[model samples]
Target: MSEHNTHIEEHRDDEASKLGMWLFIFTELLLFGGLFLVYSIFRLQYPANFHESSLELSVTIGVINTIALLFSSMTIAFAVTAVQKKNNKLALRMIGITLLMALVFLVNKYFEWGHKFEHGLYPGSDLMQLLERGHHLYFSLYFFMTGLHALHIIVGMILLIIVYFKVKNGSIHHEKYVFMENGALYWHLVDLIWIFLFPLLYLIS
Candidate 1:
């Protein structure tokens, strides 16, 4: 009887934790959505400069990072599915692939930003001093939005690392995968944000 009650309690806890994660995700959506609204308002106020700054960005790198993030999202989804099916090996591989892809995206971002620095486009640079206010505002938004999103990606990777260790230790298996699911959900959110960000900050430019 005690064992049965413990099982029931565990199930309830899983449900509660999942609900909590969803609430957190909703909060994240609102946070990014508000930033998007700001971006739109500023873009409207400085359409030409925004377009020009957008054009200066490397579409190639943006597209590549987009592809990398999308692929990572898929791998993490597969990892979650694998864990649900009790296929531990496949789950670990999928998570590893997801991590690798995330690293690739970050490396590309590093080079892209470095290229910008080489051209002296960062805030407070002499180049920025020469540019119009609209350009400054555009780059400011660009840095803030992308930097924040990148920070999320790093955080997601850290969470995945913890999940990976849990899986290794048999703590996150088919019968107890709520944590894995939450991690995957967070990663998917990261990918979703990049989807919107790429087009808005790169293609539209």
Candidate 2:
């Protein structure tokens, strides 16, 4: 029957959408995995150097950024929940809050990075000055890894902005919130990366 054909087509469309999202997520994981592998190899090769370089990082600033990212993740989660409840206003508010938190996180990172640059600790430039003293390799990886992560955070914020508008304009609804959900998932991935990065780059002995 034509009715049965229509139902089947709709189901296929839904399944395809979900599959696409999962594929995107998997690719993101692999991208980050490559960076993690590099970090692990370098850390293993220069444990002492890494530890010493890590000490130069501002623990307080890192902690604050961590808290900001965690709060943003929470806000995004709430936004997703609000959309599920069909409360567009609350969802928009939550997304706005998440965006604010993301901005705060980026600002803190800017200062942290600026402080390092002031000390001539930038990657590939004055890195030799620190490595010459024995253990600046860690700083190299720190900047490379954390710098890449910060870029991802910026990307996540942009995605959130898009999702906010989509939800606000009623393009996303309770029954059709796949885009918003996927966007939240991506944002959470960014936060999760920072969670691991904080400990690896700043907390490890």
Candidate 3:
């Protein structure tokens, strides 16, 4: 009877943890949804400027980053599966691959941003100050939105790193992996946001 009760309690705890994560995910969606709405309005208001500004971005780099995130999403999902299968070695390998993908994305972004800064195209540069209103607003939103997304990437990376260590130490094993699941969920959110961002900021032009 005691063993059964413990099992039930553990199951309830898992459900509660999932529910909490969903609630938090809902709030994040709301935040990003509002930003998306604002972007839509501005894009409609200054279609030509948005197009022109977007043309300044490198579709190649954008596409590369997109692919990296997509692969990372797959690897993280695999990590969760590996844990469930009691394959700790495979689980660790998958997490390592996910982290590597994230690193690739960040390194690409760094070079892209550095190129923009070198040309004085970033926000607050004197060149930006002289741009037309529409152009100015477009770049402002571009920097703000993408910068915000990048911060989330960094946070997601941190969370995955924690999950990695936990898995390595056997805390997140086959029988108990709510933390890994939650980390993957957050990473998925990060990837999903970029999916919307890629087309809106890069391909729309």
Per-prediction CA RMSD (Å): 2.4, 3.4, 2.7
Query: Model 1 Cα displacement at 78 (Å)?
Result: 0.4
- Candidate 3 local accuracy as lDDT? 0.92
Local error of candidate 1 at residue 117 (angstroms): 1.0
Question: Lowest lDDT 10-mer window, candidate 2?
Answer: 3-12
Cα lDDT tens digits, model 2, 142-179, are 77778888898888989999999999889898988888
**lDDT of model 2 at position 40:** 85
Candidate 3 stretches greater than 4 Å from native:
1-12
Kindly list the per-residue Cα lDDT of model 1 for residues 1-205, writing each as its tens digit. Answer: 5655654443348888889999999999999999999999999999999999899898999999999999999999999989988899999999999999999999998998898999888878898888898899899888889999999999999999999999999999898899999999999999999999999999985
User: How far is 11's C-alpha from truth in model 3 (Å)?
Assistant: 8.7
**TM-scores of the models, in the order given:** 0.93, 0.88, 0.93
What lDDT would candidate 2 get against the real structure? Answer: 0.84
lDDT, candidate 3, 37-65, per-residue tens: 99899889989998999999999999999
lDDT of each structure? 0.92, 0.84, 0.92
Which residue ranges in model 2 land beyond 4 Å of their true spot? 1-12, 127-130
Count: clashes, candidate 1: 0
How are the candidates ranked when ordered by lDDT, highest leading?
3, 1, 2
